[model samples]
Target: MRRDQRTGDHRHSLPAQAPGPGNLPLELTAFVGRTAELAALTAALETGRLVTVTGVGGVGKSRLAVRAAAAAAARGGAWLVELSAVRDPDLVEHAVADALRLTDHTHRTPRKVLVDHLAGREVLLVLDGFEHLVEACASLAGDLLHRCPGLRVLAAGRRPLDTGGERIFPLAPLPAPDAAALFADRAAAGLAGFVLDEGNEADVAELCRRLDGIPLAIELAAGRLRALSPAQLLSRLDDRFALLTGTRRDVPPRHQTLRTAIGWSHELCTAEERLLWARLSVFCGPFDLDAVEYICTGDGLRADDVLDVLSELLAQSVVTREEGPTGVRYRMLDTVRAYGADWLEATGDAARMRRRHRDWYMGLATWCELDWFSPRQARVAELVDVELPNLRGALEYCLTEPDETHLGQYLAGSLWFYWVGCGRLAEGRHWLDRALELDGDHDDSRLKALWVLGYVAVLQGDTAAALAALQECKDEAERTGSAIATAYAVHRTGCLALLTDDVERAETLLRSALDQYHELGELNSNVLMGQVELAMALAFRGEIADAVVLCEDVRQVCEDHGERWTLAYALYVLGFAAWTRGEPATARELVMRCLALDHAFHDLLGTVLAIELLALFTAVEGDPAEAAVLQGAASRIWPSVGLPLFGSGNFGRPHALCEARAREQLGDARYEDCLAVGARLTPDAAVSRALRASSGGKAKTRRLPLHEGRAGDGLKQGELRPGQRA
Candidate 1:
């Protein structure tokens, strides 16, 4: 997520895109004048397993690594893990796993999951903004290189990881001519119909040369074209330089140079723009107009005129617009933001602005959590996805600031949907654990986070941890006299029971939890999922008629409310019922629908379970080879998810039945051969094969529920792993 800013030379932030192969961010701005650097970096990647691109801040080291990775790392897809916003060393692997789109259901650490995933894949890993986490990055990089023969590490930072066999690719500033060309490019974009010509050519060259040929400095200078001629800009730069002279002789000359460039930009902004810029520093990630208006305006800067000021900043290249997951958004270069932060600190307003920033994200998480159950679920997902960096930033602020643990707990609990539903369970657990470690006066917030911790721990197959958290939550609820918290505790306790193969206890608890949800008039993704879990319990207990009735009722409710996540699980129950009644075609169609939703959401638990059932249906349809292959693919997926079939007699029954039948039909050797072949396919590839073959050999992503926003969990419906019996 590095914005490819000047590494380690200044403050840094993140970059975002609308998802890509390995979720590599799209370079928002056109990469200017890096042909030679790109070539050399690519060649270095060709020769070494680890290449650390090092340079001063503003030297475009991150940008070069990204370009090189895109060019040469196409075979295994380029995965970029942004580290500037991540403060916890333990979360680094979590960030990498998330970027690589891995969703493991096991209690294993992210490092183990990453190593297992990378062992045979020819993938490129880009580690951006690693200077702050040098030791962690060095350890991870070395371990990954030693273990994964097909892995290449392209790291961008101010300093090298210094791992053994590391190739440090030191990046220098742009050459004088290239600097001027970059300025010309940025200037022309700022002023329509503008171009570089003989007039003012020398002035532009002098500006680039005087600015040390740094791309960021050149671009900032170019942003002045609307107000100053090239000569006039150079004149101001000279004045700003004279005013900024300091006695810090030990500072790197390049640091001083880059500082002067950013300082000059700050000095030129109007008073309102300056105030806005300083306030804007609180945001370390991409922001949209609504956010700017909400968080950056109102104190001396009027909300009505925020857009005009924003447009002026955009014109000045202090802020640049790009496509975000939600829509059009703007971002400030990290170096510029650092300057603003310094000014904000000097103005004695940093605390206030930070509080404001936290409040905005807190509200966002709360609203998104509530909306996650409604028809606006997809919109909520997209918004949270886009705002994750800032959200993480805000979470960091809450956890690190004194007397803010309660708020941190609340925020962590509020993001349960994003953590569980949006495929960030490990990270969610990380934050929740941290937030819960310190005592807060607010029991409600603490209890909320406690239940959420139990929920995630259950899905991760950590039954002991799950029991501890749920027990604490229930005890705290009764002590506080909170019925809502008590109900949530009861619900997830049922989930734990469901996952541990106690279907009778699970059924009773789930049914009781559903009645509690009804009595309290609670309705969200969580509430709907409680109902679906109840149905799963009934199906596991061999009460097919009741399971059908319950699931169908849940499905109708899902359709009415535009809730697809819970609906997927409801369909899974009906699909199981359909299969039990000897309707193979109907069962396949229903489970395929379920798989489509799970795959779309990166819900690995649901995905593997669906694939398991699909294998059984395929077997019934007389394709034992494909069925065995599907089972093989499921085997490949299970480690990432958790224990295969959750180690539940009930949950494992479907898979065991499929394996036995497929083996009987194909014979042991033939079945084993097909299983090996299917196991070779990646998770996405296996799902693709399953989807196409299920659809009569037709590609079906578009036609599936995904295009309309599909993701669901039937086994506690993501509140718990998929544990229902076939």
Candidate 2:
């Protein structure tokens, strides 16, 4: 439900220009037989800006809306957001933002970013399969329509959103003729050489009628033709409907009919396949073969047997397959998943399956964290990207279950890199805060969560919260004798000090943390980054030689370890030191590399700092015009990162020097013009410009190696300067 919980990793699709490249899913099969409904829905859209296509489960509302939206795409740029997988009402905005391919670097609420982006655009937004999120959808649609005069919404759900200006276009089941035609089409696909004629017309029509003309039900019934004859299927349908006597009386007949159809399909599946279906329902979104194997196996079904049964489920249309850039993943329709979940509960294996689901994703997070500091960093990020929804589901189960709070804390704390490196600081804080609030003793997991919370709060410029969390983390670490937790506590405390310009204390804490890391053999990205922070602190204290040497050591270790996130920070300090040492070209090279890496991970803070440094280097290299432009670019990104210039001391000096020199050289009016140009650059374009030399100058070809040596050797923990408290 939250943006992070969506099925696919939402890399921005290219913006639609004139609707030539909208993201409507390509219809796999012929959009069988909904001529009248499609026409009516399209007509309704033309008159009403907000149209709700309401129907029961398996009634084809989603298909009808998409068909209408595709037709309107040419004129209004139609986009579809599939909301059945969304479970959290609060994540509705993120769902829409993902579907629109909106990736923002700002800390603004996703809703605000969405509204501001769509304010002037004329587009048709399709909210499909949104019954569970109706209220959230209604609120979002109302706000968007009120803000963007040209925006239109076409929502498909079991009921209406009922927002102002909304018109309910109730969709009935397919007419008999249409339903029969759909049955024959799918039957032909499932059973080769099968033709509907005098041989079976009556039986097909009777089967469709029994299924209540529901498109999904009809399709399921037809798919049985692969083995069962039409006469056999019709007989089976009659018995299935008759067995629905105990169904809810408050529900409509069509609802009962759909459930009976799904039940019949379930009954037809082999026992192993049925078990797999029930287990697969554990996933809230698409899942890969490996996940199915890991979570859906046991209790007489071996892990390797999953693929065979899974393929059978696919053949029977119990599960849907989608192929994306990552590869093939399977999903169940909400209706089918609901049926499976019911059976799963009935079987009394739901709790066991949920725990398996949680364990699998927790292992995945652990693997990703391990790989994050290796050459597999980018691929690891992509894999983690695809698993976010499952991760969210796991975390949800952990936090809500009385016995699983500690697991939730561990899971949230373990994903610090994914949250911080991937532009999800606010969400990270949300999970960490909730995890910490649960009733539990201060353990290692709580210690980890506390420090991660501190790190996130510091990045958000919430100094009070940051200090509070870190103090608790430090206290818990000492109490529990957790060396790793103590190291993280000391490292993040140093990070906070560095951000506040307490350079002396920062260096002392960082050195203590580094010594602890060495003792603990902590060689992940965090420890490497602790070294980077130490380098920055040393630089701020005017120990340029030692700072450069330390960063060089970090860069070598990162390169050797195949890490980029920590390496980027090392490059930043090394670049700044290079600039101060009168090596303009070396500074540019180092800073540009830093900018590229930061952009790759979407690290706003790193990206902004690098931009500001490049601007200062450019000013001294004599292109005052370009310096002003880069400064403007950095300014636009500062609010997104909070407390832009690190702290107002040596870390702030380069920005000040660049701004004064650019203003003196370019004068006021032209400087403003250049600044405007820089501010206009998108996040991607800003990185591109930083990589490209300004004023047509050739970028420096030769690279200068940063100092490579042991990190501040022979300096014991007790050797800290007087009054320097870590």
Give the per-residue Cα lDDT of candidate 2 at 390: 84
**Model 2 deviation from native, Cα RMSD in Å:** 8.1
Q: Which ten residues in a row have the lowest lDDT in candidate 2?
A: 1-10
Q: Tell me which residue pairs clash in candidate 2.
A: none
Candidate 1 residue 228 Cα shift, in angstroms, is 1.4
Each model's Cα RMSD: 6.8, 8.1
Native-referenced Cα lDDT, model 2 = 0.80
Q: For residues 567-638, write the lDDT of model 2, one tens digit per residue.
A: 999999888777666565777788889888998887888888888888766665556787788888887777
lDDT of 1 by residue, 115-225 (tens): 999998888899998888999999998998899999999999999898899999999998876677678767877788776677877888898888999877888888888
Computed on alpha carbons, the lDDT of every model, listed in order, comes to 0.82, 0.80
Backbone clash total for model 1 is: 6
Per-prediction TM-score to the true structure, in the order listed: 0.91, 0.85
List the candidate 2 regions with Cα displacement exceeding 4 Å. 1-23, 33-49, 70-80, 97-125, 144-151, 188-202, 615-636, 646-670, 677-680, 692-726
Once fitted onto the true fold, the runs of candidate 1 whose alpha carbons sit more than 4 angstroms away are: 1-35, 698-726
Which candidate ranks first by TM-score, i.e. highest?
1
